[model samples]
Target: MTVITGPLAKQERDDTGALLQSTLVDLLDLSLLAKQAHWNVYGPRFRAVHLQLDEVVTTARDYADQVAERAAALGVSPDGRAGTVAENSGLPAFVSGWVDDGKVVEAIVQVFSTLITRMRARIDEAGRSDAVTQDLFLSLAAALEKQSWMFQAENRA
Candidate 1:
């Protein structure tokens, strides 16, 4: 039962909602993974990597809100519950306990790599269904790509 309605048609709203929902799950998981790394990162580059992880957390959270709000605007219920994110997110899981700075960077790079690829596909798909959602995906892709590049730089030998 949706109380809100936007300009999108039913099919457009449905497709956009699905795209945003997937993006929401990934973004929520990304924030959690980054926070976990932020708490346990160690080694020579600990300070830098730890701070960078915080940046990722902030980015993911900010975008998650945007995506969720976009869904709500379209009369679609947004689900960011723990179970939903855990089951639906496409992001790679982070190892538990303390992690080396190098490993953290490697893992984050991998996450962003996978997320960016998926975001590109969503962007393309949304382009056909809803340009507004496609624009959001494009913005998200830029930010994720930038973060990925920064992490990749740290991982370089």
Candidate 2:
């Protein structure tokens, strides 16, 4: 078990730091997955899909930076290396090959589902820590759920 020895207690800030650290790994994985889809996606909607996927990766990178800096503030070591990210991420292993548009969306949906699940789990962990972490997680959880809902909505339409 990782023991925190800093002056800060295991309250909202620590919980927030942990969540951010964990989320960073997933965001990095998402960025890479988006890139993979961008490169190999084919059939109809190739250009649009590829461009959009590229855009998501770009956005995710910025999110990763924020999470990494937050994690650092709490004096926790970040699993920022590619190998560490692969090991830490909750997203399933990516299946290689040219993915059809629907399959691409489905795969991304699965990844998002896992991400939302992990985020909720971290929120629970924050509860054990205290109110501040809980509130921070509440905010992030809401945002993540909204994003997940949008992804699910796209697939349903």
Candidate 3:
């Protein structure tokens, strides 16, 4: 909780920043998991799943940046180091090996689902302290839900 001389009170900013930091950690972990899937996914839809995984990685990275930037704007130092993300992120650990396209989709969907659930909780948490931070979480949650839909579709017949 650094000095934040903004419209929001110091306590409000600190609370919002904490919520954003949690989201950032999850986003960072999710980005890495997406890249892992992109590198090792194989099967009949290899090319398609591989490219889609890259899109997921890009989205996660973008969201992570947004959340981190918001925290910094409030004078809070964002902890986005790989070790911090690894240890603090709530996302489940991804299996490390070449996975079939369907399995990769399943894994991605599961991750996205978990992220969306957490984001929804963060949205409510932020709303109690800052509307702007709540809006940010809302936007991120929408994008994550869309990504989840795409991943789930790939698992369909």
What's each prediction's TM-score? 0.98, 0.76, 0.95
lDDT per model, in order?
0.95, 0.71, 0.89
Q: List the residue pairs that clash in candidate 3.
A: none
Residue by residue across 45-129, what tens digits does model 2's lDDT show? Answer: 6776667677668667876776676566566666789888878887886679888876776787787788778878877886776
Query: Judged by TM-score, which candidate is best?
Result: 1
Q: Model 1 clash pairs?
A: none
Residue 143 of model 2, lDDT score: 58
Order of quality (TM-score)? 1, 3, 2
lDDT of 1 at 111: 94
Per-residue lDDT of model 1, residues 34-70, tens digit only? 9999999999999999999999999999999999999
Worst 10 residues of 3 by lDDT: 1-10
Give the residue spans of candidate 1 off by over 4 A.
Answer: none
lDDT at 64, model 3? 92
